[model samples]
Target chain A: MKTYIAKRLLGAIPTLIFISMIVFVVIQLPPGDIVTSPLDRMQSQGVELSSEAIQNLRAQYNLDQPLPLQYLSWITNFVTGDMGYSYLFNRPVNELVGERIGYTLLITLSALLFTWAVAIPAGVYSAVRQYSLGDYALTTVMLVGLATPSFLLALIVMYFGYEWFGISIGGLFSPEYRDAPWSLARAGDFLSHLWIPMVVVGLGGTASTMRILRANLLDELNKPYVITARAKGVKPLKLLVKYPLRIAINPFISTIGFLLPTLISGEAIVSIVLNLPTTGPALVQALINQDMYLAGSFLMLLTILTIVGMLISDLLLAWADPRIRYE
Target chain B: MSELKSQDAIESDNILQVRNLAVEFHTETGRTKALQGVSFDVPRGQVTAIIGESGSGKSVTASAIMRLIQPPGRVTAGSIDFAPSGSEPYDVLALVDKDSRLEQLRGDHISMVFQEPMTALAPVYTVGNQVAEAILCHREVSKKVAWDEAANMLQRVGIDDLQRRMQQYPFEFSGGMRQRVVIAMALVCQPDLLICDEPTTALDVTIQAEILTLIRQLKGELNNSVLFITHDIGVVAQLADHVVVMQGGRVLEAGTVRQVLKQPMHPYSKGLMAAIPGLAPKGQRLATVASVVGATDITTAYPLTRLADGRQISLSPSQLKAFGHE
Candidate 1:
């Protein structure tokens, strides 16, 4: 098992390197470098600059070098934990991401837990009572949850939240705690406003997960093994849970491969719309401004997390099912 | 004929008694009767095989006995009386509303082995866990005791390498080995009555004989009654002491293995016996029930043969003679 995990981690190195190259290339694909917009603003302001001054400006941002040399410098700096600078925020990329990483994880992890807690039981109930009034009711509600656009739902919820509940739904904290240092009241304020984005992002995942689980459980409930378990005098609920549910929940474990990266990346559109301080909004801004270091770092981190998540899910699946484990 | 006893012999000699049992499936199309007034008795300490082709209600009868018919299909009418040893005799149908009681009776006193051994065992759990779960469900033993018992049961069912095999999953084993594991699970609780619903139907011919022999040996050693359901007459002949021949959800003939297989009084039963490929002379075409009975739908073609006059009626002596029962 140790060797297997080591091999998986080793195999991920090449993928991470490949993705790093792609992130660099894609960032460079934009027509203008980060210097273009600032230079354009200066020229529009009617400031006269000689060719020598422009050369110095390009050298300051390391844009005057060969592409490969610039790539090597940026990559070496990135590897050594110096993630270069972000032209968009005009701050070091590390400090910018450091400020937002905690909030990003907090919301995503809680939303994931919420999704599982709600969806798994609802799915089991729906499948066990299939076609009953409760099943139909749950199915309709979850389908609506699945079909509606999340950002739209976030907007609607925000409107109603402010209108009826007198609670401001945007951002994760009140104005008083927005820039405040960590304290009980600030933490409390942060949590009080966290659910809006959590629900908006997690509802869709919960709906799809519930539906998948229902289908998987329904298929397994009729399998001959389930009948064998039932004939063994296992109580209906216990038998359902122990035998088929064990198999049905496998895909849910594998979904962790996607979920782990979201812990860092957050939900891009929802975070932007809600104005949450998360890496997603930061990455989007960096891409728009062509801030290669910040954007490339974000992409690289996401790639690493994805590989780790897939490995974790594979290990978990193997642990849960011996067939996969021994194979 | 000598096995015939009075109705008062219910709890004394028989382990299961089904009376006027009816099951129907209510679907969007219509309600289709799966079992229509089916009645039979499974004598204690012996194998009683229910024989019929597909849709003959052989499996339905087994499910009804275990009260395992799922939704859209329900036992519309039936009284399945179970007289398991060391338990109070009760009508199995009456326990439908009493879930815990029914569950207690199901795996503890009466267990069922299904067809398709390939799918009969849970895939994710280890063989030992599944077999031990069966014991744990009913008995108050610790996990260690249950595991030990499970290992012993596996050994008895002809599975070797107790140490490694117990830790392995169902997918790791062959179909025959998996069937043995399933049998070990069914017998771990030491059930009074074991219902095998075509347990060997999914196995190859050689494996089928091996499984049949294993079941026979286990029944003798364990001293439990078996209600075997199969479509193969050869399987019935090899394992069953008493036989119930069914067609179209109804019983056509039921008696001792010899009485039913040798001198079948009903045209349908005779046709079924004659349909056995091995029973036909070499190079001769195999006769089917439809052809021999001269009816496309034999279920409706013949009324059920009355067992009261079964002693006097004998038809198709040539088929019986071909069967080497003359």
Candidate 2:
């Protein structure tokens, strides 16, 4: 198993390099350099922008260096865990990126847990009561969840939050609670506003999982082994859970790789709609300003997350099924 | 005539009676006949083997008795009157639409052993848990008692280190051992009738013999009726008291193993007998029976004369002189 994991990690080097190159080239080809717009805007306002001032700004930000040298410096600093400085925010890119990683992880992890908790039982019940009213009702709800876009759902949820609770529909914390220490009161304030984005992202994802799990369970139910269980006179519910669900859920678990990307992308849209201070909006702003350091750091982090999610899925698959051998 | 009467009397003495049983499958193309009008009786304490080739509907016949046929297939016609001697005979076909009645009969009175041992047993579950499941399904027993009974059943089926083996999954066992586990599960409830469908086909010959012998021993010990299905005549010869030969969804011939083996009457039966390798000489070409031959021609060809009263009078080639056929 160690050898297998080592091999997999070794194989990932080229992949990471490829992702880095794509991110670097795409970010460079854009319309303006980081300081061009702000400098031009300041000059157009009748503020005298001298060549000495512009060159000083360029030298301070490393914009005066050649493109290859800038890329190499970025890579060297990145490998050493120094993400350099943010040109747009005028701070260390690491500090800026680190501040939001916690919030994103909280939302993503909570949504994943919520999705499985609801979707698995729903899928099992739907399969057991197939073609019954319960099955029909669950299926219809799943279809609705699938067809509705998460962003649209997020907006509707925000509107409902404003109308029903009389609470502010945007931002992660209340005005008075902002900048306060982490306590139950602040946490409660955070959670009250957290539900909308969570549901908006989670429910959309749960719908697909429910459908996949239901189909997998239905397929397992038809296998001869299930018939053998029934023939053994096993009670209907026990047989459904023990034989059908246990074997069927493996495929759904392996799909975690595909699901993580959805969660990341969906969180971005949710964070934007709800005005939560997360990496998504920050990454977007960085790209628009051509802040190479902040943008590259965020892209690399996303790439690492995608790779980790896939690895977890593979390990989970091996654990869930005894027939699978890493060697 | 006396044999028929005795067979009828044995029906009252037996556990399950299947009379004129037929099953058909409704396909997208049309309703394909799976089992034609077939009739046989499983005696109280003996094995009755139903031997046939693939697609000859032997499995369908067993599935029909259990009333487990799925959509696109059903018990289209005929009756499966299961008379557990001294009790009222319940019509299996009548229970086709009544799930409660079928559920009541299944696992409690009629249990089945499927063909593929590996696929027949749930892969995720331990062998003992699966066995205990059968006992718990019919009886309102506690987990401890059910598990104990399952362990006992495993021992009865000749599994050593029963406690250890019980905890292992189906994949951990060899092909022969898996079949034994399956048999233990089926017989754990000690149902009156055990339906085995090609139970030994997936096993190697040595293991096949062991499984067949184990089944025979278990049937003897339990004194239960077995409806054994197989295409191997050799297996049928080893296990059956009576043999029913089937082909193309029809019963071509049925009689005592001695009668079927020594003197097969139907053309299909003759073909099957002739096709048994090593039974005939290597150089000599065995006579192949024609396709259109029927039961009426069988009587004349074999010269097993039937009396006016419908008694089958056996006449050998040398005994033909007595009937003045020579």
Candidate 3:
């Protein structure tokens, strides 16, 4: 197992590097730089625009350097655990990204747990009550979840929140609690705003997960071992839980690789509709303003997240299924 | 007919009495009749072999007795009466609506060993856990006690290193070893009647002989009645005291092994006897006895005779009839 983990860690190096290169190139290929947008806004404020001032600004931010040299310096700093300053926010990139990573992980993980907890039981019940009215009802609900897009769901949730409870959707925390210290109260306040996005993002994913788990459960239920269990006079519920559920859940756990990426993209849409101060909107804003460093860092973070999710899923697969050999 | 003795004096008391049992499968195309008017008695403390070809309704008969048939297939008629030792006879067909009563009988009074041991045992659980699960289902024993009983059962089935084998999964064992594990599980509760459905057909010849020997030894030790199902007449000769030969869901002939093998009355039974390899020597060119049985249309240049006792008999020209040629 140690050897297997070492091999996996070794394999991740080239993947991270390749991802970094693509993020770097794609963020730089845009038409405008970060300074251009801010400078245009400043000019509208009747400030005198001077070429020398622009040059000084560019030099201070290291934007005047060649793209290759800039990338080399950025890569070296990234490897050393030092993400440079964000040109748009005028703050250290690590601190800015770190604050948002917590929020992203909070919503994503909650949504993941919610999806599994809801889908597994529903899927199994649907399979057990196959062709019955209960099964038909669950199938109808799953179809509705699939038909309604996440963005539209988020919009509907936001409208309901606003009308029913008079809640604000401008950001994750209320205005009074925005800069509060990280405590349970502040965290609870933050989570109140997180519920809508989590539900919206989790609905579509839960439907797909239910469909997959239902198919898997049905297949395992038909296996001869299950029949053997029944012939042993095992109770139907115990047979379903102890034998079929364990084998069937392994395949769904391995599907976490695809599920994680879907969650991230779904979060992006949810954040946009609800105006949460999450990485989704931040990444979009950086791209639109051509903030190469910020955009590249965010993209790299997403790529790293994807790789980590896949690695975790593989490890989980090995843990859940003893038949799988990592070698 | 007087020459054929009833042999009721040698027959053990009946344990299970199945009468007019029929099974039908309700498929999308239509209902398919799988079993038709199958009636037989499984005697106590004796082995009764049900011999037939594939799709001859032998397995279906055993499954119906256990009440294990799934949806789209059901026992449509008749009764399966179970009379346990010192207990009143209860009709199993009447308990279809009362599941608790049926549940009380299965795994405690009756247990079954299926074909293909590789699939009969769960792949994910340890062999010990699977057996313990079976024991605990019918008994109120603690887990530890159940597990110890399971280990003992494994030892009884001739598995060496019982402790180690108990911890292993089904895939870790060979076909013969897996069947032994299955036998251990089936006999753990000391069921009054054990149903084995072609238990050795999936095994190689050597393993098949060993399994048959193991079953015979176990049957002697337990003195429990066994309803063994198989198509191999050789296995029947080695294991069964009494045999019922079935064709197209009907009992073609039934008698003791000696009576059935040496003096088969049914034409289908004679055909089956003639088909057995080595019954006739190589290059002697065994006579094809296809005309007596109408299911297959193979032509034969021979005649079938109606004996004075009214049983149809067919004989090969090379063989002399000890009894007058029907």
Model 2 spans with C-alpha error above 4 angstroms: A1-26, A29-32, A43-56, A63-82, A117-144, A159-168, A173-186, A325-327, B1-10, B76-108, B136-167, B250-252, B284-326
lDDT of 2 by residue, A1-327 (tens): 676667667877888888887878788898778888888899899898789999998898788988878888888889899987887898999999899978887787778888888899999889777878998999899889889988898888878878998877787789978899999999999998776677777888887788888899989987988877776656667777888899999887688888878887899888988888888889888988888889999988888888878878877787677666423
Model 1 agreement with the true structure over B205-227: per-residue lDDT tens digits: 99988999999999989899999
TM-score per prediction, in order, is: 0.92, 0.81, 0.88
Score each candidate by Cα lDDT. Answer: 0.82, 0.79, 0.80
Q: A244-275, model 1: which lDDT tens digit per residue?
A: 99899998888889876654443777888888
Query: Which ranking of candidates, highest DockQ first?
Result: 1, 3, 2
Ranked by lDDT, the better of candidates 1 and 3 is 1
The per-residue C-alpha lDDT of model 1 at residue A251 equals 85
TM-score result, candidate 2: 0.81
Interface RMSD of candidate number 1: 1.0
lDDT of 3 by residue, A256-305 (tens): 77787788888987888888778888888878878776777888888888
Compose the digit string of candidate 3's lDDT tens values, residues B151-223. Answer: 9999999888977888878888999999999899889989898989999989999999999999999999998
Model 3 has an lDDT value of: 0.80
The DockQ figures for the candidates are 0.77, 0.46, 0.48
In model 1, how well does chain A match by TM-score? Answer: 0.94
